[model samples]
Target: MTIRVTQPGLSTTVQDLGRPGYFHLGIPISGGMDRFALRAANLLVGNDEGAAVLEAVFMGPALEFTVDAIVAVTGAEMTPKVDDQLRETWTSFAVKAGQILSFEILKSGARAYIAIAGGIDVPMALGSRSTYSLGGLGGHEGRALVVDDELSLGQAGLGAKSGIHIAPKLRRSPGNPAELRMLPGLYWHRVTDVSGRNFFDDTWQVAPEADRIGYRFRGGRKLEFVDREQPFGAGSDPSNIVDGCYPYGSVQVPGGTEPIVLHRDAVSGGGYFMLGTVISADMDLIGQLQPHTATRFIEVTLEGAMKARRGRQNLLDELRASLD
Candidate 1:
């Protein structure tokens, strides 16, 4: 049970939710940037939420599914075709043997998930099947998949038919202006009121300097100068002073200016403010943010965030109902 890729597009790698419980060893929670989409895709194909899936960047590779299997695509808005026909994403479907799947330029978002039944066959590293490019560990030889790469399923291959499938309501990509929500950071008051206002008021544009590791935004609106005391009152408050840990959705604002939103491949380290975390629910949508896209940060209340999370749970609840 495997599939062969004739072309691996710009970037492709295997990922699950992430490597948990090992952040203490300075292991970043390197995994899928878009957790929701990955989980949703897996659920669509009867795979566990932790199952590994292919996270494709930009367009995708042209590949042939040698084994008959079920698959689902999610995350970015890309034109995907299987056997020369358009394919529906966020839903499960069968791919006949020898069928080729091709991805065209992303139409809306920057990433997409292609989940194969039984999950993509990849060896686990550090108790997870994610790709950490910087460390060059885990997933397809510890790097982005290349042309002529063939992936195989491990134990419990897809033997059952896709009894049913559900397609989520297609979500449009956030426009050029995106008001991303953020929870108060541990160092919320570390910055001048002007800096805090700028952070929440000004719209920063996503710069070309972006990748799986993080996104660099321009026009972050400078912060006002302060007495610069022990890094306590200006936008320089770090989440922790420990050695290292899982850096998930942490926005590290360096020099009280440009803020980088750390993603899947962020480092496990200390010394940065880690001022805010992109609410877990929107991390995937954040992953889909395009280069040059403008974004604003709004402080979302904890109660409101909980409601948003529950709303997502409701969607999953409906999906489970469909499986019944």
Candidate 2:
């Protein structure tokens, strides 16, 4: 199968779920920027939810397929077109062998997800197929995709049937706003009552300084930092206090200025007092934020967080149960 990239848009790369279990060594979980949409698109194409998919940020590359393939688009919706005809997102389609697929400028969120029946074939580094650009690890030479890159699918194929298509309900819609749901962080006590109130009351716009590493939000009320700052423990906060891990959700208020909520690719542990964590369920939402787009962070109690986790676990259980 020949897949050639004639134009690799503003920024495009291959990403799977993420690289986990290495935070202790200060490795960030660099994977699909928008996990939900990517996983959903992969699922629709009969590929595992965590399969490698193409991540298009702000724009996308033009692809020329040499052989037949089934594909789906998700996440921040960019009007993707095949040979200049406007196409849709989230729904799987059978593309003929010589068709050229291209994505225009962003019509909605920041990143777009493209998944095919077979996962993107790439050599795994440290048990993941993600691109860690900073460390020069996995992905296409540990960097973003440019024009003329060739991609081939994995051997784990889902046989494509004739005329199979998905419904509109399964496709991701464009221009949908994403909110970051979160729980109080370890330094929740350090925030003043008034600042805390403003944090939950107002919405912040995505700052220009955002990427696979983290989404930095601005325009919210300037938070007052406390004189008391403490260290974060290792083994998933609130546990034994070891050297903090590298990347995680940390609402860092540096210089007593606006908070920057770090996401998956964030440093494992941090010294900046954490206001709260965005939580796993909403990380995808955080990742899809467009610069200047509005977002609100809701503060939940520890009990509420546990409930949310359990609820999400139940949903996953049901999904897995269906397969069983």
User: Against the true structure, whose TM-score is highest?
Assistant: 1
What would the per-residue lDDT of candidate 1 be over residues 66-161, giving only the tens digit for each residue? 777777788886766878788776656778888988877788788898887788778889889998888888988989888888899754344434
lDDT of 2 at 99: 96
Model 1 misplaced stretches (Cα beyond 4 Å): 155-176, 229-247
Give Cα-based local distance difference scores for all models. 0.75, 0.73
| Per-residue lDDT of model 2, residues 1-324, tens digit only | 757899988878889988988877878888986676777767667788898888888888899988787888878768778888877776667667899988877877778888877878888989888888888888778888877888888754555332334444443332334466778766677668888889888878788878777777777778764444345443322322344433376666665466677765667665455677877666666767788887788877767767777866665555434332
Each prediction's TM-score versus the true structure: 0.88, 0.86
- As a whole number from 0 to 100, the lDDT of residue 310 in candidate 2 is 81
On lDDT, the candidate that comes out on top is: 1
Error of 1 at 244 (Å): 7.9
